[model samples]
Target: MIILLIWVAVLIAVLVLYLRQIYSRFSRYGVKHFKPVPLLGNMTRILLRINHFADDIFSLYRSFPEEKFVGRFEFLNEIVLLRDIELVKRVCVKDFEYFLDHRSVFSTSDSFFSRNLFSLKGQEWKDMRSTLSPAFTSSKMRLMVPFMVEVGDQMMSSLQKKIKESKSGYIDIDCKDLTTRYANDVIASCAFGLKVDSHNDVDNEFYAMGKLSSTFNFRQVLIFFIISNAPKVAQFLKLDFLSETSKKFFRKLVLETMENRELKNIIRPDMIHLLMEAKKGKLTHEDIKPNDGAAGFATVEESAVGQKEINRVWTEDDLIAQAVLFFIAGFETVSSAMSFLLYELALSPDVQEKLAQEIKETDVKNGGKFDFNSIQNMPYLDMVVSELLRLWPPGIGLDRICTKDYNLGRPNDKAEKDFIIRKGTGVMIPAIAFHRDPEFYPNPDKFDPERFSEENKHNIPMFAYMPFGIGPRNCIGSRFALCEMKVMAYQILLRLQVSPCEKTTIPAKLDRETFNIRLQGGHWLRFRARD
Candidate 1:
């Protein structure tokens, strides 16, 4: 017994020394960081669920306002949060090649998640990005406007039905569910070429599966944390972040869709068609079959079909992976944005009225119809959406991984003069923190669209206002997302007045459990039809 105790004591001492060394990493480099606890590092708050990831990051970001960057640990792995907008600009754009990839969670062997554009590193990411860029060009977005508008009309029709059914002349609606249904239908039409009326049929198979795939339960969250913090362990254990069931479902769906399209020679102005063209090594601006009279725009003429020398083709798995990414990403983030926008509008009646007036005036100017050009031309609508995004960015933070050694230099005398960031270090840009910082926007909590107005917007710093991120790695579907939000807002606000009800939370409180920015209770709004 004494011998066993002696061995145990030695083991404990060795571990303590090792962890002390790990926690001292930032101090060695002359960087400031939150004091770390043993194994948990500075993630105790997040791990304990005392605060959401974004909230924790924001608090830390605010804690060290004078520093250009602050170090923290995700377990033993040190992560540096770039607090300086100029440093953020340098990392995201000017010296981007050094930080080309996001810190990878899944191994390359996990094709389902690894092959997607978001996870792909180096050349693979570049190739896929080039191939997919044309699919979201201005002309292609113009082609998609009719489809999006059709969904918007369906949404309004659904709301009308709800109001008619309500005996009180107004219906209390869960804005999250309402926006989610609209987003599901839009993505279903645009990506899968399947028309789904999620507003009418809430239990539609596609939407159900999409919800399943996007949801992160407790077990999944734990697994994700482990994979993100200690990827090597996950790789050694052969763990995949995506469920096998989701993988199979999406793969089957994509295969069937491709086979049917090929068999019938059917073509549609959507993502699947463009992906099909890419598979055939023929994706180009010309290959995009425009909607009736829609004009074509310039696109990079790059073939992404196969590496002929290696005989490795962009397989069906690749197509399905990308399609699934598009569906889930578009579905959840857009719905989240729309829900927040409506909730803010409901709470602030003055802002809502002004935005509605702008929408109505723009419609009148365009002969009572919202077209691609007219929707894009509404300056006030743009400001409101921008402000909403600033308050509630769908992606709370942006991450990048160092691919090569980088010598980061100080912009001014206040910061460290020269710091060497080794390859493989993870860098974080806290969008939530930057957006909410009072220094950037005076009176940050106020829902003021004037902050983003033509004259006032120039006063805001460059990298400080990145809701969709910056540089080549930014959200590829930003334009499509904005179009969807604008069309929905235009349709709903023009026909109905959004007001707070008995159940509406005065200042929306974010749900602590989920990482995605969602309100604690469902967003409840009373909608009354305009005469």
Candidate 2:
């Protein structure tokens, strides 16, 4: 008992000394400090379950609307949550080179997917980004449009069958589940060039895994909390994000596909095929089929670093990691965006009517078919999507770390406070707080699509509207994801009438425990054919 007491005393003293250091550091920068507790820092209330972290962040931002930035501690680490729109602009856009990488806890080697775009940084990120850029270009998306349309057709057919088979004349739909399957079809066709028919097979291995990744339980959340909070120590211990099952499944899948493609000359216009072309120097060559995977390059450019052969192919691990990440990131964003989009439609019938009119007119102009240009050209459709993203961003927070000591200048207009960012300090750009700021957005609680219209969009500050992020490191698949979502929405709206169900939450709230911005409960809505 005496030993336990002594150990507790030592821990308290250590915590106090650490906090005093942080406090002194903030004082030096002339940044305002939040009243913090001993061990858990400013997040004690959140960690103790007294309040949700998102709400706490919102409150903090609201409390000091005049300040350009606020200083707070997350345990021993100092975090600067920037509030001023211009300051955000500096971090994400104008001066992005200084804060390029999102702080990821996992090491690439610990799993097959270590070198994914999300985890890569610096020169490595630049090279990979350049290589993958052409894959998602307008022409590339045009090539893949037929596949996306086919998936949407399959989804509509599947939903019709489910509705027909329903005993109550109304099918109860788990919006997340339906959207996940749709996303599975999208990713499968576009990423792997394989069609698993997730619409018919809810239990399909890929679909199940995708759904599991989106929905987390208590244990998974706890493990994530630990890893994120102590990433360096976790990395030193060789901890990984990919579960053993996911690692085995994806690694085997990518390797077998590569081998089969090489043997059979099976070329496709998907991401895997593009990466394979990069490996063999055949990106510019036309008429290369999947079976032509063995096609060798005309010339191999030397690696910029000169450490590797220019024609050196990606290893099996590299292919698998990239493939898995493509599926994981691509699927979640598409599915979540659909969920929220539908959630909005259910709540606002006037908005739905306007969107339906837009869809109908565009289809009529396109020879009664929802062609590429028709769907892509609808201006209101684009604004509605943008507004959905602005109100409920697919991600709640965007994170970065100070790679070098930098200056966060005070608000140029208001001149409230200034601060120096130290290296290794983690920065959490609370996207929700920024999106909901009434000062930047008038009557922010209301769902307003006109906010994204051509003239109105300019009224908003530059960095204030980044759903797909900004800078060179922004989401590479943004166009693809948007295409898939728009296609799905067009097909569904054309065939069926959607209305909010009792199970749907009128004002959607988030599950704080989950890592991403997900609904507190699953999005549920009723669908009827528009006959």
Task: Estimate the TM-score of every prediction.
Answer: 0.92, 0.88
TM-score of predicted structure 1: 0.92
Query: Tens digit of lDDT per residue, candidate 1, span 34-62?
Result: 89988988878877778877779888898
What TM-score does model 2 achieve against the real structure?
A: 0.88
lDDT of candidate 2 over 1-531, digit per residue (tens): 999999999999997787788667766656666777765678676565555567778877778767788877776678888887777778876777789787755553556545877777777766566555556555677677778888889999999888888886667687877888888988888888888788777688878776665455545554555565676676676666667777777777777887899899998888888878766655542221222111011001122221222343556566566778789887887788888888888788888888888888787778667655664578787777778877877766678878898888763345555566877787777777888888789998788888877788778765676676655556667667777777888888877778888788767786665555567777889987776
Taking every candidate in turn, the Cα RMSD to the unseen true structure, in Å, is 4.1, 6.2
Which portions of model 1 show Cα errors greater than 4 Å? 236-238, 285-313, 410-417
lDDT of each: 0.81, 0.72
Give me the overall lDDT of model 1: 0.81
Backbone clash count for every predicted candidate, in the order shown: 0, 11
In Å, residue 452's CA in model 1 sits off its true spot by 2.1
